[model samples]
Target: MSEATGWPFWVMVVAFIAIGMGTSCMYLGAVATCAKNYGKGKHKGIMLAVPIAAFGLSGMWQSQLGTYVLYERKVDGSRGDVDVFRYFLFLGILLFVIGVIGTFALRIVDDEEEEYIDRTVEDLERSGLLEESEFFRPRHEIQAAYGTFNADAEEGSVTLSEEERQQRKRDLEREEEERRKKNWLLNYETRIFLQDPTMWWLAAGFFLVTGPGESFINNLGTVIPTLTPRSYAAAAPPAGLPSTHVTTIALTSTIARLLTGTLSDFFAPVETHLFPPIPEDRRRARLEAEQANRPTLSRMVFLLPSALILSCGYLLLSTPLPLIDPPLLHLTTALVGFGYGGAFSLTPIIISVVWGTENFATNWGIVAMMPALGAALWGVIYSTAYQRAVNSGSGFADGQCHGWSCYGLWAVTSTISVWIAVGVWLAAWRGWKKRGIVV
Candidate 1:
């Protein structure tokens, strides 16, 4: 297509990129808002999981709709006729409608902010559950309020001497005055988030897990039809195994998202809950002191299983034997789907956990691009390998590619790459553990 249009194809490319960016922004914005509203409450993982799960399930709905609605059967036994451009138009209109409706419906209530501040400290003292002095606020806010809350200090900065307290108040007022004149988007929280290494670690982990899954998703249509003998391809349904694989993936991925996110919340870090014997105020002080320096782990330990599951699936395809059978392909796709969902859902919640929710929208958006980077890299590998295989033999005819030999090496390489990604995440996990962090 690009060769035919030359420079003009760049217009289509740019438009597609713009569309992708727009959709991503909407998604991250919704997720961050939802996560922030629920982050301080119980079951935060499950609360944040629903939006991402919907994202996973949307692909299945789109696949089924496009298969039946966009393509018409020919008079002959084989299916041929398609109105792809019209189908895309329909999709665009549908998306626009959804976006409009969602914009109105997805409300993040701001009315409770004053109430939250008023009740938070009192409630913590009453219930003995508050972790830090500024557990609900951004770290920058905490710092600005009373300097660092040192555990061993004479009064830990919370009960500063009258003169010291007055100085701190003035400092906070000065900081607030400066903040009022600045853009909220480029605020201190965002600057702090950019400097954190844990964010990069999580994003890299996202890239590693999703890259091969994306490669599988993108190549499945080509892989499935071609894997079968040429005789079978002519008789297969227009929306046969490929569509089934994709839908199955989405379904499983959605399930994974819901289950994993909910489970993570149930397994909240011990530090978050109230411990007895110690006075409520003292416990709160200790909790705050601990939280001040450490990044919150978003129960990302839940994803270790997902990484292993995906690795197993990739291993199956990497084997020398042809995965020509539909049942086996469906099973593999389902596993991949689960991992895909887990990665997407968990990463956002993790970002919300580790990084303060003050700049979650921007932080999630920054990390979300890692999967795309992975996809682009793996896509190149799959494309090059498949093309080489096709060129080496008598080329494909009638939309049918012949043989498994083409994909075997690519599959193995992808499997190795995925395992390496798993290792990277494990390293991150170890680092967290070494720093006395819990996931």
Candidate 2:
């Protein structure tokens, strides 16, 4: 490519990284906004699922499009693709256009405060305070309680003395403090969330489950050689294409995400009742406390089926495939995809359940880092194991790997690791059941 077209390799690397960062930042902000605004609604899971499913499915779309755009047939009937640069350029332009359109089209207007205000107003009226003329008087408790929305305040502007202005500022500050107190469970000191053992346990579970799934997806191209005939392994797209595997995985993942997220809503009624209820007298005091951090629980048990599926996927992969025809490798990939997508879809809801949504963006960011950590660690394990297997076998010189021997150890390790993650999740679930905390 460099000989034919004066393109530097380093420039492509730089452009790729820069574009990736920009796109990731856009999605992060957009997804966080969606979570914060609609995190509590009936269709909350589906709303969150759409963005994640798009991200999971994009890999297949990009792979197919790039293959179509870059493929070229030579006179000798071998591959002669030289349009790699063009393929990336097309993808970049498409992303830019979509990002621009989405930026203008999407918005999140949070009206959560309005719900809080209505509740407070109803409480005041029920207590017979609203009927008192003194409640509307200047410097009254109700006036201060409502702050800027004080209905008794004059419509016309009026100048105020320095002392009066200071008093008004104090009242506004007091109002904010009261609101925070009322919604205490929705707020937490970062230190408290950090100190919680459950957060780390969840991260550990993420580290375990996500590592194997990521490793499977990332190593699909390499593993395909062992699962198919030699000629097919060496062939490009439209012939002996391994992209079918990629497409299958992506399709299953997208479907799983949409289905699981939507179905979780149906179980919400049964699942929410499992939590311990607040005492009548303690409810108001709890809400009014400085640190009203509660042990949050969720319908995370809904994810058990997905986790079991992942276990089965890894078990299949761990089995030797010398007779590839006997067992379909694509089925394993699809199972992994389904499990991965379900886990990804459920994590946000779980986070919102375990940790209050008041600081969701920050909490999710912390929780999300576990996957990357897992990926880095397990990627090395899988790749290193495969390389060792290849080196021990007779095909090292020609760069040809044979049979399930290549990934057997990697698969075994991954299978065990995923089940361990399942155990950890179960422990957390039991904790939630007993104490309303994920522990």
Candidate 3:
């Protein structure tokens, strides 16, 4: 639709909206499915990371394709113009083919099969027929059931008294009710999730930190030209430079996603406290069992460093340094890419870990929407600064803003925003730690 030469403005607007909606739906579906399927495994973090990394990687290759194949070459062998019609058509066809393939290729394991495997493993472990190295139960489940086998063995047999049996039954009933509430729309669980102060802190922090990233990525093409020297004012900017930076960002983002995901799995602190509070004796046993394995680092630890790195990137961009003298713009993009990708990947993992994966889709959706507001806020600020520079006659004859005046204010504003986000995230991390809450 965008390729149509005579389409009304409203038609283009509608097409863009439809495309955005479809892309969002696909992203959410893919991530949620991975979270649901592999969220209980030992390598759940890495499992979840794969899809997110792929999301970043797709941008890198696609941008490269558009730059090399979709752009028209001039008679002098220089890149002349983008063939938007061909580019759009290629994307549409490629996406459609991939979507069709994914529809047939993607499969979630059946609950019954999962349950059977877990049950079989537990039975084997109980019979002392399974090696410790062969154990495959989720860490939490293993911790929860840690002392049961030993206790049964010590007693030769075990039996629950009538009162104890009644209590157990009540506990199971309550748990079932809670699960049902979580699944229901506008229920108690929804209210609790929304009312949680921690959730809002996370949302606010995400908004401040990620919004700048979104704005930067969207305006990168425009920003690059502003950094060009006056000597090149009469000439077109290097065609490959913007694409090179984009590819760099995308590549670094993918790596950051994978790195954070894998490291968090090995190092994130274990939460010994289970909700619905188990009996004190059992809880004590669980804690004792977990003490030997607890990691000192929290998953939240990753967020602070990411925010700081992103802030540094913004600060670098805000500087009046010439683009080529130091060739540091690539460094700026790398830091921003790493920070943005790490935070994006870690947020979902934190949600699943802290809130449980049973309602992850809803929780993630609410938190994820915050970046849109941030992006809009920063986008407006960036555009305003650029226009101000242009109006002040600090721009070229063609009305393009040049040098630091074009983007310095916007970068500084984003730097402050990201630093504030760092503070917010720090506060949340401290509060959670003080309360013995796992992030």
Ranking by TM-score: 3, 1, 2
Model 3, C-alpha of 18: deviation from truth (Å):
1.2
Q: What are the Cα lDDT values of the candidates?
A: 0.69, 0.67, 0.75
For candidate 2, lDDT tens digit of each residue in 1-439?
4656766899979987788677776666666777767765666777777888888888788777666656676899765654676777787788888889888866667657456444544554565545662323355654456655533342332566657766876677567655654444233224556776666777777778888888888877777666655554356421135567778778998998888778765444322211123333554454345134433224566576777888788888777643355236777888989988888788776766555444666777787777767888888987777777778882544685666777788788888887888888777677665654431
What TM-score does each of the candidates earn?
A: 0.75, 0.74, 0.79
Best by lDDT: 3
Clash pairs (backbone) in predicted model 3: none
RMSD of each: 10.4, 8.6, 11.9
lDDT-best of 1 and 2? 1
The pairs that clash in candidate 1 are none
**Model 2 backbone overlap count:** 0
TM-score between model 1 and native: 0.75
CA deviation > 4 Å runs, candidate 3 = 1-5, 75-78, 104-107, 112-182, 233-240, 272-287, 322-326
Tell me the spans in candidate 2 whose CA falls farther than 4 Å from its real position.
1-16, 73-82, 113-189, 229-233, 236-240, 270-298, 437-439
Judged by whole-model lDDT over C-alpha atoms, candidate 1 comes out at: 0.69
